[model samples]
Structure formats: structure tokens, C-alpha cells
Target: MKASRDDDPRVGLDGRLSWRPAGAADLDAWAALIARTAAVERPVWFERREDLAQILESRKNPTAGNSVLGFDVQGVARAYGRITKNPDGEKALGFGCVDPAWQGTGVGSGLLGWTEARTRQRFAADAATRAAARLRLFTEQQHTHHSALFEGRGYRIVRYYSEMHRPLDGTLPEPILDDGFELVPFGPELYEAVRQAHNDAFRDHWGSEPRDQEAWAFVVNDPLARPDLSAVVVERAGGKVAGYQLASHDAQSAESRGFTEGYTELLGVRPEFRGRGIARALLANAMRRFAAAGMDKAALDVDSENPTGALALYLKMGYVAVNSSMAWDREF
Candidate 1:
């Protein structure tokens, strides 16, 4: 049923649907739509209402363009899309999802079209600062329909990522550290150093972005973050952080799947310190901590083509790819 003209958000030009800008109060509606979509088995990160709220908060930074357009039918919010302008060399846009109830209603097309237009407008505003801008978005590989949708609009699959999981039986390979290195738990004070080390560790990585304090706090300080479960390895020789693993929880998702899981949100070992067993030590310590905390499993996602053999290492450590997602891209 269509809503009264005055009560509806801006109507679809054809009078088939309606939409309006969203705010924090729309969290539950967004979460409801997301829950409907996540019911499908796929390699995708789960998002709770709090997660969506935090992401919206992250958009407060000037560089990350944030827009949430709630799509509705008869005054009820049933679908929505959020596009965030990310670190610019690639000119990335955040993920978008629609309600299954509106699949054939042109909602998806309208949303993607808006994302591209919004991205272009944002990059144009800072044109003098941008160089070689390319637009990109990520979607689940199993969603062949979505893959077809992007490809139909000139996007190409640029990368493949795997959602990997490991049972937390407290049997992760023991972290083996060299004589001059030691594992240290991260404290709030090391926020800056950790951010710096993240950039250094991922400088050679594909799609890596530099993070400022705002970005760091937005992700690392999320509600599920357990600073105690995270581990940092420092070279005792000069007290420099060689590697680190930041852990978080997806309690809702885990419980939904019948086990509690801890996430290795970010894990990296600086290039100069790669072969010293720093990464292994960090992983082992984090995994042990999660298991000790009574988590039934541990998880992380990896780029399938990672040059560092991260996927192979995770497999070696008994983690298995539970799902795969593809990165799609097109030049702006």
C-alpha cells in the first residue's frame, strides 16, 4: 500500500517507492534489513545495530563521505544503502545492501546509481587533491545476482577474499618468538604506534589505506574490542613493535551459528620483521586468549591473492575458508 503523499518520504519519480536520508535513530530498521540478508550462508561480515551506529559515526570525518538513504514502502523502512567515501587514491565507496522484499523494484539500481554519483561528486569537490581515482565496492561472491548486477554496470571483479574460521580448542600453534622479541598486550596508550605499525605492515598490501586517529578509534575501539585479547610483539632490542593482532567479537553472529567466536580484526607484521615468527606469536597469543575467554571459535578474513601467503598459513594453522567474497571495481 502506498502511503499518503504527505506522509511518505520523497517518492520514486514513478510513484513506486520512497526514500529519505537516514540518521542514528534508523539503526534498528537497518539492522532488520541486514538480518534478513545475512540469513543466506556466505562469507560476509555480520553487522549488528551497534556496528551500523559506529560506522555512521566514522563518517563524521570530512574525508569519508557518509550518506544513508533509507528506502521505504508505504511509510515503512524496508531497505537502505550507505556509501562512505574512503581513503582516496582508489576513491572507494562503502558496501550497499537492499531488502529482499524490494529485489525487483529498481531499488538496487537506484541505490548503486546514487553511490556512483555521490562518489563522483565527493571526489570532484577535492579534485585538486585526488590522483588517478578509481571506484570500488565489495560484494559476496556467492551472490551471483549481485556479481551480475555490478558487471552489468561495467564493474569487474578485482579481488577475491575468504572468510576463514578456526575452532578455539586452545590448540593454536604455539607462537615462536626470537630471543630479542616478546609478546605484549596492547594498552590504550599504544594507539598511535599501533596505527603507524598498521600502515607500515600493510604498505605493500593491495587496497591498504592510511588511518588517522578517528579511523583507528572507529574500528579498534568498537564495543567488541578486547584490548586484553589483542597482542603486540615488540623487538626488545629497540622496543619497536614488529607485529600485532587486534581482536574483536561478533557475539551475535557467533551465537546465531551455534558457537561463540572471537575475531582477529587486524593482524600484521611489519616487513622488516616478517621472518622472525612475530606473526605466528601474535596469532597464537590472541587465539589462546580468546579460547581462555570461553570463545568456541576464532575467525578472520583474508585476500585470496595475498602475496604474503597469509591464506596458506591460516590453512596450515587449521583455519578453513568458510565463505568467499569478491571485490568489484570500475574507474571513476
Candidate 2:
């Protein structure tokens, strides 16, 4: 399913640049290109090599023919783009970047155009997605150039997200659960239960769709995932999973950023269990666990318009907004 170079959009953009489907051999170069591009905008987080590898090899969203890499004459990757259709067939997520040195040479535009075309091909190939499908991209609010690029292509901002951080130096709140609910450490045995709880909890969230078992496994089994730091709240009466806090630590990012931090990757409480202090308890427990693990801070991202009022809860927990990003969408 490799794309022929003759039809590549990068052909005229730069005579010395060649475009091809990215594969296992391009992992290192692709990661290096991503790091360089991210530095220009000072993103709040960085993607590790393992993270990129997992994405490239994911089972549910395979990148076999849905990704492209633009390499220089010297054989170094200078740009990359990938599109993945969600399992539910409602949207296609796109990610791409061009090296800072190659930014103005039309590389970014070529990569974006290719990604959009790929997205359309993917949607048309699937009967379920062709009727109501969209292509979504995310960029930090400060990246004005990125915004302009997407906007020029008929994309519009659909949602905003805030990255919040909280220092673990001060006294932390006690994880006080209600009488019927108790906090338990995350483990493999509770994986399915927690996954079900997560799906139910986020059913009403914007742009959220159910995660099949394969996708859920990929998340909980990630290399950076920290089971010891994660916590799940269960109802003692029926042993029902009421809430969960999934945490992860990236040593590479910590070292590069000069600060150790634990990321609360996903946190959710079942609708029926809301307002019973389950969410707060799960968060407090995660914060204390992170501090106990010697992390200097804890961080998480929340949609600015989350229906559950998560932003207000994070702010009340001493997390301050440090950065912001926007989700842009273009319908097919």
C-alpha cells in the first residue's frame, strides 16, 4: 500500500525531499523531527520513543498506509504526518509536523494536504464513517502559525483544553472516601471493570467514544503507565467500580524538562457516583502517591468546557493553568 513518489505532494515542494510511508525503520528519524518541531512552540509535554512506537504499531489504529514521511536528500526525516480513524468511525485524528529548519519550504502544507486526503480516503472506504465523518487536529493556542495553516484549509476551532500543574511540596489533602466507597490500588484483575467504568463515565463527554478492549489494554499497559500510583474507587456494597485515576511517569520528559512530574492521564467517575466525593478522593490519592514516589509535581489536562466541571475541581485542588491547546475540525 505504499504511495508512489510520482504522486507525492512533496515532489514539487522541495526537489530534494522525498515522501513515502513511514515504517519501523523511520522511528528514530521521525521522533527526532517531532522533538525539534515541538521545541519551537514549547509544548507542555513531550512524546517518548516508546510512545511513538506504540502508536505506529497500534492494532486498532494501524498506521500501515495512513502515514507519510518527507525525507531530505541526505536521507534525514524532515516532516511527518499520520491519520487514524477512530474505532467508532465518527472521526479521523490527524497529527503532523515539519522540522523548524524546513518550516517555510511548503513541507508543512504538503504534509497537511496529504493527511487530509488520506482522511477522506479512510472515511470513504468505511461505509459507517462516510456520511458523518470529520478530521480533527490539535495545536497549542500559542502556535499561531499552526492555527493559520489549519484555518486556511477550512478547519475551525471546536474545543479548547487547558494543561494544569500543581506542586506537591505543600500539605496534600487526605483521600476521604464516603462510607460505602473505598479506594483500591489499580491492578490487572480490575482492568476490565475499570475499562467499563471509564466508557460509562465519559459517554456524555464531547468527542469521546467507547474504547474497545484492545484500545483499553493499550492504554493501561503502556510502558510509562504506573499501576502503583493509579487508584480506583469501588463501592463496598456491590464491588462496583465508581471511579478511577490512571497515572503515568515519563523519565525522559522529566529529565528534558528539568522537573519530575506524574501525569494523571485519565480520571473519571461514573455518573451515578458523582457528588459523593469519589472523584476528589481518587485525585487526592493519586497526588499523594505521586509525591510518595518522589515526583516534584502532578499534572493533567482538562477540556475547558467539560460538562462535569472538572476544570473547577482541578483549580480547587491547587492546579493552575500553565498552557492551553485547541482542537480544530474539518468535515469531509
Candidate 3:
């Protein structure tokens, strides 16, 4: 089946529905669909209206690597998704929601097929780097249907992870900064140190790979990176370098998307600092920030089998397992 063109409506299954590239003109409809979809799948982490708008803006910018598409029935969108190729050109596609009003109408398959085609066109079109083309996404393990959809589309699970959360309504834990260790706010100045710490911290973990400094800089510099919510480290007594905790707010935006929950982007403690409660301290600090921001709940996705005891730590901190997802891939 041919994909829809930039100027054409995508006609699907018996011509009962159509899809097209989602644009600024479709913002209101897009927001409404997203809100309704989230309401139906409460507690799921989907993109916010503002984030969607930002994504649209990036797609229009051409130079930016974000692209989105929508499935419509007669002129109303019932399903939608996006493909985001980061600065490094690594690509991933995230999609969902069948309008309840149109679950098995072939809209879902069409959207998935189109998005995959676009992903291939974007990355595999270049002969010099076609082999580097890879598309990946995460789905809640509880989302059996959605997981099945991806599997049907030829995607395979590569790793498993969990979403964990903790509440901050009770007494705060006293943070212990080992002699010569101190907690600090992450800022532009600590970019290299933070990246170095992350590489060192996760080096031995399965699938862990060193990140390029420039790409790390772009991530930390992105407006959506949330500097205020990010955590870092310095020395104590005299101030040096130790470890870090990278957190961000998705719950606030999740509110706009019709939910409430914050996300812990990355939580890492230097190798030498493990077992000293530094990770817990960083988490407490993050929870404090979440509460201060008026969030009633917070969450983080973790490798379910992290060799470092991260998952157990989250459980001990009040983070009950709500949903789980796995990373899937196949030799390509």
C-alpha cells in the first residue's frame, strides 16, 4: 500500500478512513484526541499538548529531526504518532490510541506501516549509512495489545524496564554526604563532569554505551531538559566531583495530556559512591523538587534487572511497580 503524500489524505480500508501528516491546522483536534486517549488509558506516560506542539514546530523546521503523522476518518483524526530522529540521527517511533471509536478499522496498521516506511526512508535512504538505521520504542508491559501491535510490525524486545515512583508527603530523610562529598545543582558548567559520571556509572551495564559529549550537551541544553529539576554533585569540605541524578517533569505536562506524574530521566551514582546512600539521597532530593512543583506523584523507568540494585532501591523508597516495558530489536 502506498503511503499518503504530504498533500494527500491517506485513504485506508474500503476508504472508510484516511490519514495525513498532522500539522499546525490540526492542533485542536490533535489535543482533543490526545486528551481523550490518555483519559482512556489512565496512568500511561504519553506526550503532553505542549510537547506535541513543540514536536510539530520541530517538524516544520525541516532541519529539526522530529516528524508526526495522523490518521483521520473523514476529517477528524482518530489515531496519531511521530518519528523522532535525535541530533545524532538515531531514530525512534512512538504511536498509540485507536479512537475506541475505530479500534480494528485498519487505521492502526496503516499508521504503523506509514511511520515505519518513513523511518526507513529517512535513515536507510543514504547508501553510506543505511546499515546504521535502527528504530526503537518502549511500551508498557501491561499494554498487551500495543505490545502485540509492535511485535506484529516486526519489532522485537531487546530489554525489559520498569516504571517506579515514590511519594513525598512524609518526613524527609537526612542526606549523608560522605566526607568530602556534596550534592549540587546540574548546570552548563558541569556538562563534561556529568557526562563523564554517566559513562562511568553505566559502563558495565547491559547495552550501556558511552555517549558523545556534544550530543550530551544538546540534551542538557534543550529547553525541555528542565535544569531546575536536574541533580548533580560536587565535593564536600572543599568541593570536588562525585556523582549525579538527572530528573525531569513529565507529570505537569502529563496533566495537560490528561494525567499527573513526574519522571526520573536518569539516576546515577559514581562507582566509588555506591552503598553510601547517595542514590537514595539524590532520589529524595528529586522527590522534594517534585513536591515543591505541586506534583502529587513521581515515576522513573528502570532496568528491571539492574545489577546495581536500583530496582530494589526504588521499591524500598515507596515506588510500587505500576507498569513495565521492554526494549526490542533484531539484527538489521
Candidate 4:
């Protein structure tokens, strides 16, 4: 979509600004725009060309259903927004931001309203989905301006997720699984079980969404996914999956932040097997492996109010909160 006038419902394009659909060629410019916004807005997070490329690549379905828009002022890109659906198509998710210089202008709101409308359009494409669809956005809890924006726009805080890290320099205790359970590296034979384990583990988690095979496969097949680093537990009694953790890292992030680290992307213990130290053992094993790989630190994110007491467990394992963020949601 292209617009250069104030009457555009999707976005209020001020006279000097132009709105254009983002394309592959915009990857570098998009990275620069997002980097500038993050540097001033959420400094704890880092962005790379890969991140923007990933975004553009994810929503390349050739429709407004999943698209990004770049806002240019005087022929220079200064803002951007994107909207896409979750795997289940029950939610329309995206975010928008303006350069620091344009922060106080109406640009951010314009982009937000526009992105939300696109997401709604995605839902409206089908009556069955439109009736169940929702619009969601995210921002760090500490970024009060963002929270204010979401709240003013009728969004609510649905959950709090925190990232933590612990140094790997010191010796750590050996991992111990349940009496009949054993820790093993992920393999093709256990792929199906891994899917069941993750879904069952987070079935009751707040804001948890069920992931199908395609979604699950994407994570497993990502170039950065390390099957050797991932953890999976098998109960010896009946040979069922108990818990698992995904270990992956971004080369760009490691270089940008100047550190060697292994991130525990997803950790979950089956509901029937909760409170049995399964999660702890998996985490310890991951830490040990990361240290063996010469990683200086290990990191993970946990819900602040997880029913499984994961935050306490991570803290007990010497991890400290390095950043905090929340999931903001809206229904329309």
C-alpha cells in the first residue's frame, strides 16, 4: 500500500511523509531504522540485519495479511511497522516505532493504528477466524511510554516474562535426573515426542499457544538450533518424554554484545511430571554443556509468575534477572 496524504485510514501520512510497502531491498534500511529505535527505546535488546531480514522474510505472503510498512520523511526512512498471524491464526501480532527524533510526533500512533488495521484485515479474510481473532503487541515493562501507549490504545498486560543469566566460569553441580529418567541429546527418533513434550508442558501456561508440527519443525530445523545442546529426558520405566530445553544462540548477537553464551530458548516439564526436578536437571545439563563449549554464560527467560516455580529454580541456580518484559494484548 502506498499513501502520502492525511486522510489515509490505515495511517495518517503527514504531508511530508510517504508510506510504502516494505520489500526485500529495504532490509538494510529497515535494520538501521529499527536499530535506531531500539538503541533509544529498549537498550537491553540488540538488533542485527538478520533480525530485520527474518521479519521481512516471515511476512512475505504478498498480501496485507502479513506485511510491513516503512514511513519515510523527506525521502529518508525513519519509522517502520509489521503485522502477521500466529501459527494458529488466532492472533494478529506486530509492533511499530518511530525514530527518536520523531518520537513525540503522531507517527508512532499512526503506524500502530495502521498495523492493527492490517492485522484485523488478516482476520477478516475469513469469517470463522475473524470471530476468534485477537490483536497483540509487546513492550518491556520498564518502558512506561510503550505501556502507556498500549493502555491508551486499549491493550492490557497479560503476563510478565524475565530474562536471566549466570556466569559459567565457576564449577557447577552435576545434573541429576529422576531415579528412572536419563538425559539424552535430541535425535530424529525422538522428534515427535519432543513436540508432545513441549505442548503438554506448556498446555496450561499463561498465554501459551499450541504449536503444530510445522511450527515445531521450524525451531528444530533453524540453522542456529543445536541438537547437541538441546536437552530431552526419557523416563526409564515406560520411556516417555518428561522434559526438554532448546539451546540456541545468534551469531550476530554474540558478536554485537561481545560474549559467548548459550540461551535456553524453551524449557518445559510435562504436566504429569511437574515438581520432580526435571527442569532443574535439564538446565544444569545445558549449563554444563555450554561451559564445555567455552561459553562464558548461560541465559533463559521465565514467567515471573510461573506456576511451576521455574523463576525460583533459576535463581537458586545462580541466575540473576538482567531484564524484564511483558506481553500486552488486545481483543477486537
Taking the tens digit of each residue's C-alpha lDDT, what string does model 1 give over 1-332?
78465332233322355655566767787777788777753334667787777776664333133454555555666556656655444565656677676676777776776667656655665645455545688887778878888999899888998888898874567878889998888988778888999989998888887777788888676878888889898888888888999998766666467788888989999999886777777877877888889988788999988878888788878889888888888876
lDDT of 3: 0.66
In candidate 3, what are the lDDT values of residues 51-166, reduced to their tens digit? Answer: 55655545222312333445454677677766655433444444545576766667777766555655666665444443556777666676677777878878888889877666
Could you tell me every candidate's TM-score relative to the true structure?
0.88, 0.93, 0.75, 0.85
Q: Note the residue pairs that clash in candidate 2.
A: none
Among residues 3 or more apart in sequence or in different chains, the pairs in candidate 3 whose N, CA or C atoms overlap within 3 Å are 141-324, 156-328, 157-328, 158-327, 158-328, 180-236, 235-240, 251-261
Q: Considering lDDT, which of the candidate structures 2 and 4 is the better prediction for this target?
A: 2
Off by over 4 Å in 3: 1-18, 57-68, 71-74, 86-91, 126-133, 187-226, 236-241, 250-262, 270-276, 291-298, 330-332
- Compute the lDDT for candidate 2: 0.86
The TM-score of candidate 1 is 0.88
TM-score winner, 1 or 2 = 2
User: What is the TM-score of candidate 2?
Assistant: 0.93
Query: In candidate 4, what are the lDDT values of residues 1-332, reduced to their tens digit?
Result: 77444434455544346767777777677778878877667554554566555444443234333555555645667877777665445777776667888877877787787777776666766555635557878777678888888899998888888889999999886798768899888888888998988989888887777777766766786656778888898898888999998888765566556787888888989988887889889999999999998888999888888988888899999999988898888887
True-vs-predicted CA distance for residue 44, candidate 4, Å? 3.6
Which runs in model 4 stand beyond 4 Å of their true positions? 1-15, 55-64, 71-75, 87-90, 130-133, 187-189, 237-239, 254-259
lDDT agreement of model 1 with the native: 0.74
lDDT-based ranking: 2, 4, 1, 3
TM-score of 3: 0.75
Q: Write the per-residue lDDT of candidate 2 for residues 17-76, one digit (tens) a residue.
A: 787887788889988888887778667665656778888767756767788888888998
